[model samples]
Target chain A: MFEAVYQYRDQLLHGLGMTLAVAIASFVIGFLIAAVLAPLAVYGGPFLRRAIMGYVALIRGLPELLVIFLIFYGGTVFMTKIAGRYIEVNALTAGIASLSIVAAAYLTEILRGALLSVAHGQWEGALSLGFRRPRAFLMIILPQMMLRALPGLGNQWLVVLKESALVSVVGLEELMRKSVVGAGATHQPLAFYLTAAALYIMVTGVSTLLLKAYEARLIPHMR
Target chain B: MSLDLFLPAFLAVKNGFLLTVAITIASFALGQILALPLALGLTSTRQAIRVPVSTYTFLIRGSPLLVQLFIIYYGLGQIELVRNSFLWPVLRSPVYCAILAIGLNSAAYAAELLAGGIRQLPTGQWEAGRALGLHRTALLLKIILPQAYRSVLPAIGNELVLVMKGSTLASAVTVLEMTGAARVFVARSYAPFETFLIAGTIYLVMGAVFGRIFRFIEIKVAIPGR
Candidate 1:
């Protein structure tokens, strides 16, 4: 297994690059989407809030693979229909979009939970200090939420990384898809998979430790 | 738009829908049973047990379920020993492999949740149990596990919903679950959009229904005060 992994080192490295790229790209996009959606879900009017909540529920409920599949195939068809011409949706594009949607749903919830964890009195305190609502939220509430949201966001990052593997089915040359190709070529399915699993473990386990240490450092200030 | 395919697609995928439900229920049940010991191991004082169990959970959690399924479904069968072993019959079928992979993955997650619940148990409760002349075994059985279960009920509910969604990946291994059925239809009709839209709706309904049930159970089983 180790020999096979070594022999396929270049291929595997390329796959790893793709996986990290997709994960990082989707995470940034998802974070922005969550930022907009979380505030709406938390503070919007009743009808708007319900609409956002329902969107979250639908995304959360469906499988990520299905979402990717639907987006890849359905998006192509929909776009083709709109233009009355073929519009090929690339595998990488579909994967990132679907993963972003899923990540956004979970991130929204995480942010909302963190926001709620900030004491109601803190918001009132800022308002009483002569700052307008937007300025108060930006200066006071946002910092505390970030502190509280760190641990959950760390876990969500791991989730997005792992979920990126599903994009392999869409023919995205991410780590898992590359591993599949390598396994088929080498007849070392076990080695390729175990190596993939190990890579995932290393990425997630190490990042989690770093995130936790960071969270620990921030804890005193939040307190 | 293939709106005409809607009823046929719905009817065609009925078996797949049932299979999905079966896999989810079976995996969740087995995972819950395995989770107890795993949770206990996680909360154990000994590093020998705790380290190994924690590593297992971490590895399982870090990796995607699709990879795990591929490992078990395709990778395991490639092993000469596995092919020669008594477990070959079970390992040969894609459905059985899906159950094992999904079950173990979920058990790892539930174990973490359960262990966290156990750890959060008040130290005063343990002291009270010890002060009441309860043995360690009796204390854990009567006092600890019950409270931990209550606290972890909602989390376990989340785990079930996760299992339901995760089970869709079994289609990659030819399990013919909802997603699998839709893929088959797409292959034949070349209508990915309509077929998947139907399958997605079914999954959405399943999730909503299960979510409501979990919420109901959580409210009904809420502790009197805490």
Candidate 2:
């Protein structure tokens, strides 16, 4: 098992790179999607808002594992049909896409919750101050909502990082998959897995400390 | 594939939901039980128990449940000593192992949530309970638990949804739950999206329904819904 880790040092590094890339990409895209959907949720009539809410609920409720699988398998199938040729959906990309959708759904709620928490009077107050519709959002609302959302977003980011493990089944060579590979090659499942756990701990531990610091600095200012 | 395959997928998601519910309720129950003591330990008027429980909560809260599940289900199961120690039957089955894992996981989180609510309660309530001649259990059950549970229902509800989502980790260990079923479907037809899309729909619907039920229950207990 140690040999597996040794033999695949470069590969493991690559896996970490891919994992980080996937996490960042999915996070950005997911936030964008959620941003688009959030306004729809808030401003649209009951029917439109309900439609968006339904989408959000389903995405958030389902497991990332299932989402990854669906995207990998379904993306390929659907893409092939539309284009009249097969298109391979790489495990890493599929995992990112699927997770992004799931995260976006969760984030829509996060944003909505934050949005609601911002008193309605602020909007009218801004408008009275001659802040136009768009200017009001940028100056008056967005900052506060973002402050409220920071902690929740931090938690969700951690979740996304860990959920990337599910991408292994789709054949992504990330940390979890590398651990599996190492375990298989060396027949030291326990050792490799434990090492994998340590690596995860290092990543998460560092991030947790950072997020806590960020929260401490931000929470007081926001209030 | 044939229609028969769909049955298992549906059955699997249903069973998965059942397992999901079972895990959430059991985990919350156990978590609250364990965490309260631990929280008390944290604020203890003692140090020995306080330190270890704090450490336990920190470690558990810090790690991902996927790793924890793998450790409990696969790592522990692989050990001959564990098998021989008389927990074999339960440890061997993925379901039991999942419950143990999830319960522990929730315990770590719920203890903190409960503790937060407990801390937020008016100190006068405790004093009032003390004046009423209530001992530990009666004070907790009568005054503390109800208020904490009420105050934290929304937060706790969020945790419940999280636990339900977390149960998908069980699919990795060969449990044929909802995600597991969708996985099987994808493995068979290589149509991950359709299978997962359908599966996701089921879960979303389940979550919505669960949310409504919890809301109803919350209303019944608190402001009493009309």
Using all chains and alpha carbons, the TM-scores for the candidates as numbered come to 0.96, 0.87
Candidate 2 lDDT at B179 equals 81
Name model 1 segments beyond 4 Å from true. B219-226
lDDT of each: 0.90, 0.77
Place model 2 in a CAPRI quality band. medium
Clashing residue pairs found in predicted model 2: A70-B192, A70-B193, A74-B193
Query: How far off is residue B19 in model 1, in Å?
Result: 1.1
- Runs with alpha carbons beyond 4 Å of true place in candidate 2: A1-13, A44-47, A218-221, B1-36, B42-47, B78-80, B190-194, B223-226
Candidate 2 backbone clash number: 3
The numbered model that scores best in DockQ is 1
Best model number under lDDT: 1
Fnat for model 2?
0.46
